[model samples]
Target: MPYFSICGVPNCPNFAHAVFVANYLSEKLPNFFYKKIEKIPREWAVFLDELNRENKWYTHESPVIWKELYQWGGTKYLIGGLSEFWEHVYCYYGLESLIPKYALDELALDNLRFFADKRRSEARKVKNVAILGAGQLNSAILIQDLLEIKTLRKGGVHLVFKLYDHHQNIDRSVFQHLNDTALHFNSTSFFGDFNLVELYSSAEDAMADSDIILNLDDYNPKDADFGKHMNRCTIRMKMLADHLLVAAKRDAKIIFAGSGPLCYMATALSKACSEMFPNIVVITADKGFPFVTAASEETGIEIHRISAPVVWGSIGVNCFVDIRNAFFKADVYRPYRCSLTAPKGSTLPLGVVSSELRLMGYKIKDAGVIERKVKNNTKKMEDLIGRASLFSKLRAIGLLLKLWYADEVGDEIISLGVRSNGSFHVPKGMFFSQPVKLSESRVWVPYSNYPLKEKQTKKRIKQCILHAKDVFGNLGIMYDPDDGFDEDWDDYSKYLGEIGEGEEEEMYE
Candidate 1:
């Protein structure tokens, strides 16, 4: 009827031996029971000291043992260290087959690995994601996407979404409904156990220790004046940037998802915190363009198969989609064969053909059809949402986040608003939407050598850059033409065919 407690550092040889003996005795003796308590090696000394002070015993090292003599009027008995326990068991139970030194060392090594792996597993399970201005509809869609996406389910990651919005703006009922949905899904779905949604009263509390911060703040102005909108957006962006500087970690990615000049806002935030600029990004609405979606619907091809349709310039205005290098994988194509009936020396449009996959470059002749479809779709979306395609934008954000979490950056090309490192003819210190490949390190590298042979493409890109500068100057974030002459401004002015008095006003407009 003896009950014992064994305490020691987790990976100690003596501790392993003590545990082995205790297990052996508990199995043979029907009335015997024991408990094992493990402490890390660094914390062992303090624990051992406290144990000795409480028990009035002077014992050092690991494998400290004690017996509770509850059967005999609840008296406590100290049994000293590992050797003493071994001797007591040997004399009392007549057991003498001691574990070999090498075996005990191996046992300790196994315990060390187990402890290390357990710590790593715990670290991998918990991921903190902060959503700023989470009361928006797109934010709700994003939350649902994160919870239900199959790609995220594979990692066994427990997602903690910390939602923050202003007191007047935030919807508590929406949060309550989402929480109820999460609970219901967690019981029914296989991977929904890993999802959790939390609401925070303060922005600082929500953003603290966040691995990914999504800025879904609704900053678009109701005013029709573009200049006034930019000015208001600039003021709000600066305030958010200041908050992020104080609360966000150095490595946490701050993704801007607001409905404004996305590239300019991202650039302004990046300039505010230069050291963390690389981690700041804006998910572009390139893949969500009406033309891209129309192509998918027309050809019956999955939108993901259509890759590398570069969206250059900014998000809303002065943006251009280049499909010159776009490739699509499909099982069927138009019934035009490259035979003698066709033009002489015409070859197949296929790039890579295999048993499982056939990748083909998009034909330039289909551009007219796609353009018409784009116009139709654009008009429909504008009529519905007033120039804001909420569903498409939500899908784009969801897709980007899925790819980002999966970290399987293959040959897929995505358009992201990232800080320009003077690559792809984009100016440094500005955020521009360009075709980029995600590296294994999770960094988005712009395709610097991507060809821009078409004169119109080049001209459009130049105009976008100028428009970005004008917007920044109007908001007083960076540029100021009235103060003094700048090198980039002077150079762009000369390149754009010597702007006249009337042309200057038109360019800004």
Candidate 2:
């Protein structure tokens, strides 16, 4: 049987789509098969343990829970929540179901008729077709829809199944359930064979002599909370993307499925294939899920929603307009927040994650892990500035320290500034992380460039470094300048001095 696959991280909502389409296609068409990718769960567990320490979560049992914790804490919150993730799977499935079962059979019959006429007119070429990402449950439904499409297309397209997973352990019941269901329906129109191999590797080998690469990998967060899960998932996804890019570079037509996140990933992959492949189509069904929707905006990607049945029959129907057209017509790249509406702007979808975080006593400020590097870097700069080194080499080294501190320690500096903004504003329990530099200069700033409680920002920066040293043990910046910093911090003092001493003020809009 020819193969189609669905690839996703553990507990992926999109997995439902894979399972649905695989079984549906297999049952409706004899030559088609769907397979999924699985990974070694233990390896994931080890990785989780390592990350837990860095996060300071420190849970010894239940790697599954720990992984989920990481994801929920990381990017998942930044976007929306798990429900939004599930909506992607649901919308794709729901839309697919809208295609009447018999309607697809009729379409298949039409395709047979069309191919018959064409074959008689000119010898028909054998089309080796495959659908990727077929392991998820929804994939079974997607498969059924594709079979109806085949009948309408006249059964000319042959298929080969590619079910790829990293792990050998697929819940046997799921496979048995699908195999049994497929065997029962037993339609004889599909062409090709089925083989389940390790993902990406198998996909790469299969694409070596193939004409089309159907991609279905998206939103895979390995063992982390939803918030940080996508980070690891994207690493493996990049490999599959590279393979698709190679095929596209070789002029292969690509059809992709899934939600907004997948669409975002596709932009980079498609660009790689852009020069080689003439047409690239991404089919997504956004059910107005907040997370995927916000992610769509954040990534600067567009998803086109078409009637599911039309896609199954391979017929184009009323399709979705680009998100910008549907909402913000201009300022398309504007950041998504609570304040944005449609035609002109759309309000950000308030989701359960953020709401739940608030309910569970999680503050938005606690969303990220604070890096320790900021404190260390700040001290190196302070020491270099205080040192009156006349030696050119020592002065040169000091200059580099201040630049590094300013750039890398921006978050540390900001945290100090915000703390000075007042105990009432930022308050306790709120922490700053993920330092980013500000490029714009403001003559009339909201707050003075000083630390809270009338302290100099530089002094605060220096004090934080000293506190860290006392807590974590002496890191030896002032003790050993050469070993402490990479460069001369003395000369950098001239630049740091310009920041000046001033009273810190409130930092609110």
Candidate 3:
């Protein structure tokens, strides 16, 4: 899910008003969530300095631009400056251009109330289910739900509750729960780990024996000493994905128990599985308050049920149970059409910062959230993984470039504008495509927001103006790849010469 942050000094008139609007908006928007942190007093800085555990100052201080942005972005449009901090959201996302005015209006307090009060229904058609992760709390609730679902099954849909996890200890306990539950019901439940062979068996069995796989993996990060829990989860998912591809025959619904922070483990695992087994469905639910349910439109995940924080304590627990019943009968589950947009004809190097940025963008656009992409790739999956990573980097770059050049360059001509990273949502307005190469080693492609033709025109115009200004003045800016201005203009000169000659009368004629 995309995260949004609102910031300012708590007592400041501008800050207080923004908070009021933020609180109201959080209450209003079905898709939007909020995390409010109280301001840290400047006087407390001395106290913080005294404690000095790695000088956590860096952690508490907001980014340099974010503070300035909070002042500029949110103030103009908010109610009594209450939403002043949100201006960053509008600017960063280019939201005015992307989000329809109607949609924004729908998020208003009155509009949300109308939608919330309407006759809402839960999904009830799902039968066969696979439950991943064998955590005691999650598994216990999952088993109970399956038992209830079994009573609904009169052979309409065969149910398979396939359980997966990385903890060997938890596996044993999960099996005991499954066995105990099996004695009471006629449903089939299976368990496995990261082992490819085992994963293949479990996934194949589920595809044949089940309809929906309820993944309840622990999204919590494990201690470094114990090993990265997320990495373990990804490894398990990769193995599970390979097995799912070989095992699932036709349409299968794969639902994930979303992590606390929308970990990419589930997204990556679901994405990989979807790529190979395009027929399967994937859905994820938020674990926070106003718990939203998203059944994959592409992977067949949709965000449903935006319950409040208090509801998360109990109702959220029951949401897993509710989903099983809803799964059997709901048509709300739609496959994600193009959320995980991969780079065309390019193999992204895994763990590379550039590629990761692209993957993040793709995932955000897909899920409609500002969640990070999972870092998992191997020698064999390098190409696909590269595409994922590069997509993420591109999205980040688009936002950065937009903000970096926003003031000096007007929006009409400036291509890159940087905004708050937290404000992005899904079904990316941006398109991903292959680059038009200019040389064997060098290729030129437009960023996410710019179309090819527009980019080409802008690039030429910008280059011409830049060179003209450079020749007129001694603007000796160093050429560096980091800044967009530092391009190999030799290519530009050649390109310009070709155009210039094309326009001139031919001497031979």
The model with the greatest TM-score is 1
Worst 10 residues of 2 by lDDT: 306-315
TM-score of each: 0.61, 0.29, 0.29
Candidate 1 wrong stretches, greater than 4 Å: 1-124, 138-140, 148-156, 167-195, 286-289, 296-305, 329-372, 381-388, 407-409, 479-509
* Candidate 3 runs further than 4 Å off: 1-127, 138-140, 143-172, 186-204, 207-209, 225-231, 258-263, 270-509
lDDT of 1 at 154: 60
Model 1 accuracy (lDDT, Cα): 0.70
lDDT of each: 0.70, 0.33, 0.34
Q: Is candidate 2 or candidate 3 better by lDDT?
A: 3
What's the lDDT for residue 225 in model 3?
32
Query: Over the stretch 1-509, how does candidate 3's per-residue lDDT look in tens digits?
Result: 33344443333344344444446656766655544333345744554344235323232332111231233334222111233345654654333223344544444444334323441211223355555554423344444544443333554433344554445344566566545544444323333311111121244464554554555445555565323453455566678778777765445545444342222343345444646332221122122211122222223333442111110011111112111112111223332434346555545432222211011111123322311111122223457654212222223222322332233332321111111111111111111111111212211222233222222333443443343223212211112212333443445445555555323123213
* Cα TM-score of candidate 2: 0.29
- Tens digit of lDDT per residue, candidate 1, span 43-100? 8889989988887889887889888865633555989888789788888888877678
Backbone collision count in every prediction?
Answer: 0, 82, 82
How do all the candidates rank in terms of lDDT, highest first? 1, 3, 2
